[model samples]
Target chain A: MQENFIKATAFAALLSASAAVGLTGAAQADSIKIGINVPQTGFAAADGTSALIGAQLAAEQANANGGVNGKNVELVVYDDQASPKSAVPIATKLVEQDEVKIAISGSYSGATRAAAGVFQEAGVPYISAFAVHPEITRSGDYVFRTSFVGEVQGRAGAKLIGESLGKKKVTLITLKNDFGQSLANGFKEAAEQFGIEIISEYEYSIKDRQFGPIVAKVKSDAPDAIYASGYFFTAGPLVSQLRSGGIDVPVIGQEGYDSQKFIEIAGGASEGVIITTSLDRDSDSPEAKDFIAAFEEKAGYKADMVAASGHTAMKVAIAALREAGSEDPKAIRDAIAGLTLEASTGTISFNGLGEVRKDVQVQVVKDGNWHRHSIISDPDLLAPPEK
Target chain B: MLAFELLLQGLVQGSIYALIAVGLTLVYGLLRILHVAHAGLFTLGGYIGVIVTNATGSLLLALLVAMPAMGLLGIGIYRTCYQPLLSRPPYVALIASIGLFIMMEELFRLIFGPYGLSFTAPPLQDTVAVFGVNLKEAELATMIGAVVLIGGLALLTLRTRIGTASRATVTDPKMAEAFGVNIGRIRDINFFVGSALAAAAGVMVALLNNLVEPTMGSVPSYKALAIIVLGGLGDLRGTLIAALALGVIEAYGTIYLGNLLDRDAIAFAFLIAVLMLRPQGLFGRA
Candidate 1:
């Protein structure tokens, strides 16, 4: 009994020491570790690394300016592999094992959805950067994103097409996954509201390469424009096949087309295409400029919106952490819901579930590049365009 | 316009199905092992071809490197993962193959990064218009390459000594072994040949689409399984015919459904019906 008591006492001592280390061990703590969960490899590998680089640059810049509460931030990353099945274990490791209080993630909506549940259960705050699924915010208070839901992007895209570009006959070519489908559905509702006739709609598999038949049928519909909202893998070929078929209609897409490689794949054909996205690298916002410059210098490549979103998510979480002055999940969640930061993207403020409520911006693909096309109307806009 | 475009596109996709299925059928004919790992190898080929193109900036060089690399990797994988399990339950090797597929895919993810690699098909981006229907130069190339690969596989099986030995081994492994034929060597060669063809198919896909990902092989791999079942597992002639049929059917299905219905469902559903009707496969040795 004495031996058992001694062992228990030793274990308690160790626990106290670890807590001391976990909390106030700043001098010896090396840095405040925040887990960066994204798909660093797999289908989302490219954007995953881009997001990681943003987190890395943010942590670096934060340290350069003397980190949060004098504790340098450390980013310990785990690759969610862009698969829902893979995200659970990685989130488990981050929350239960690594014990990081805050994480930024979500390369694929499905993966983000899978990880969000794990984080909420574990009382760890997770910020999704590029995953814009509307359902993700419903995961709970602990889950948040720098990017708004697809509903926003979709409605904005439909508005831009209906009100701005003046095209009525439309067709949607979307990835059939829930994330892509949700956006398509959102666009469909909005387009109908705008009195647009979506002559036809098509959904492709996530890995489908040949878009020959899909594009051909859309051409038959003779829609004034097409909306393809999958990533470069599927979208590139879709555009290529469209061009080959002489369907030369103006193609507008979602955030998936924001990557540099998208243009690289679509090349000459991608010119004059437009896509709705969170923030363009060429944003006139000073914060956006600074972040882009630092990111470009660090990664030795142009920064994508996904990377910018991740850095912005960290900024949101870190700001909330400071406001709460504690690592408690509930406190942080409340602080995030009330966050108001002039971030690189825009003024980020969240609704009840901690998802940012922001305007959706439409960007045009011109000269084989994505450039701001229009400021998508919000209630805050000079005037919300006529309904 | 949509139907016409869908037809040409479906033909291109169908061609790819043919390329992938032929190799799968070949392996089943000789080894009697349904290698799920071939998909991993197929995906590996795409990524490898991308890397080769990036580093060397030569499409030809990328093909040269990825093809032989996949072939050699196939032989090595068979020796390490399958050879020992050959004597064990047949299902054992298949399960091991699934594990190996996971491991190889994870390793690929580690090495290749998750985002797909893009190959610039500047030359082939040009299209040829026939009967007011658009056909991409890349798709045409893909079909041509598929034909060549299938033709070569057929010729190799008919003419070569190793091919004859493989035939003998396929007819009766025990008799071939007693006749002093090196069954192990034949298996290794067969695996290498199958994997090499899959790599070639990968190159075609990458070239045709200008994109490749580690998980890219999964869809084609599953399609190959569907085709094998439909064609009669061990029957080469039926596999080819099934590939074309699947390709055309999927293309039309995508169009008829107005793009909402995924064409893969058609292949999968057909596979289920076939399994119910013919447990031994449509064209497998009766």
Candidate 2:
């Protein structure tokens, strides 16, 4: 019994020694660490990869200008795999293990939503690069979003679908998730304002690639337009299926559909698909031109809306850090809440809800490329409706 | 007219389901290995098919090359992962298969990137009118290919020597071995044929959908699992029939009910309902 007790004590001592070494190893104060939680695999991996590129560019630019009060910014990235279950642990690792003052989520809404509570509980400032779910920012004051809320994008989409395109009767196909449901709700609420009648609303699983029955229903109903609320993967096949099934109504989507991959997947069926996004690729602004040139050169491809949002979010985080002139999370959060800067997407300023009120670009697919259609600058349209 | 169109749509979907599930059933019936990695093979087949199609500009060539390649891969998988685990518990082999599935998905993601890839063949993009209903060319190809392959498999099992040996081994392995049948060789051949069927399903699905991604195998694979179970695990004819029924039900349900349950959920719901009434599945022997 005495030998067993001694063994237990020795084991306990070893564990303590190891843990101390680990904690000391992680708490090094060499550079400012900004935790990056992005989906490197799974459904949203493409967007995550693009967002990573944009974040890296932001870090490079900041470092070139001498990062945040003479201390270089170090981006510590982790793959949340676009899953909420994965995001929780990743958030804990970023805050407690990596000792980061702030975290940037470049993943989809699900992951960002999952990590927000953790960051808030830990009192670490959290910023979502492109996730647009309104509830993300509403999680707590510590959480902020560089992208506009889904409700804002959906309202703009409804206006474009109803008043601008003059399609009064519509069929809605939603993705059956938080992002899709919220967007659909926003569109449904505002759809009546412009005399647009929603003939039918069909929800589908994200895993669904077959749209035969859905297409048949759309054909029989024969609405003036079809608004699909999903990401580019679903939108691509949904458009292809609809067109191939010979139901060629105007198809409209939100920012999730704004990617070159969508056009490629749709294979000419993407023509005339109107989408509301945050970035205008053809903007003539000198700042836009310069940002685009620099981004393309660094990224080795054209920057999409998500990539621009990521770059903008990183810039905002850095700006907050600089303005605070300290590494305190509370100070950084305060600086971010009051930040106002011109971004590649537009002028970024946070509302009371910590959601960015920025320009939303409207684009259309024509001749297999995204062409600028119009810009919705109305603040009333951009603001999230009172809860 | 709408009902008729829905029936045809069901048949198209059912054909693809059967194409995928049949191989899974075959492997499970003879080996009792579960073969969860079958879905990964299907996705690999899609990648190979697309690569070949782009390189040769012939969908036919893609189909031919992808099947053989996947068949060879199946043999390699059996040799490397399964053969050593044969002496261990069956669940050990299942765990290995799950590991393989994850690795294959990661490899495909690394090779193809995370975006959805277009698998369009220009000649197959045109839609054809079938009984006054518009159907994509790939759908027609899928139906025809499924029929030929399933029919051929049925015939081979009914009228071939290897088929008889395979049945013998599955029924009583020790007895079959006593009668001079090499059970190991039979298992290898079955794995090859099963994996080839999964690959074929992958190619057809990619063609019909006009897009393929690394994670494409996961959903269909889960559906395939439900299919194998609901069709009375390891029952060949039962799996085929259940697959068709599932397709028709999913079609009509999605149309009339309007996404009250997701199409995949509808399938599981059907499986549960059927299992409640008949626990041995539709065709499991007493």
Q: Each prediction's DockQ?
A: 0.45, 0.41
Q: Candidate 2 residues A1-387, lDDT tens each?
A: 234335545765785476446433543366788988988877778999899888878888898898888888888888888899999998999999888989899998889999999999999999998887778988888988888777778788899988889999999999888788888888887888878899998888888888888888788888999889888888888899899999878898988887888888888889999899988878987656667788889977777888888888898899999999999899999999899987778888887778887877998998988889999888887785333
- Write down the worst ten-residue block by lDDT for model 1 chain B: B114-123
Q: Comparing only chain A of model 1 with the true chain A, what is the TM-score?
A: 0.88
> Considering only N, C-alpha and C atoms within 3 Å, which residue pairs clash in candidate 2?
none
Clashing pairs in 1: A41-B114, A42-B114, A45-B114, A45-B115, A46-B115, A203-B259, A213-B6, A216-B2, A217-B2, B232-B283
Off by over 4 Å in 2: A1-30, A385-387, B120-123
Q: Considering only chain B, report the TM-score of model 2.
A: 0.96
Instruction: Supply the TM-score for candidate 2.
Output: 0.94
Candidate 2, which CAPRI tier? acceptable
User: Each candidate's TM vs. the true structure?
Assistant: 0.89, 0.94
Residue A130 Cα positional deviation in candidate 2, in Å, after optimal superposition: 1.6
After the best TM-score superposition of candidate 2, give how far the Cα of residue B6 lies from its true spot, in angstroms.
2.0
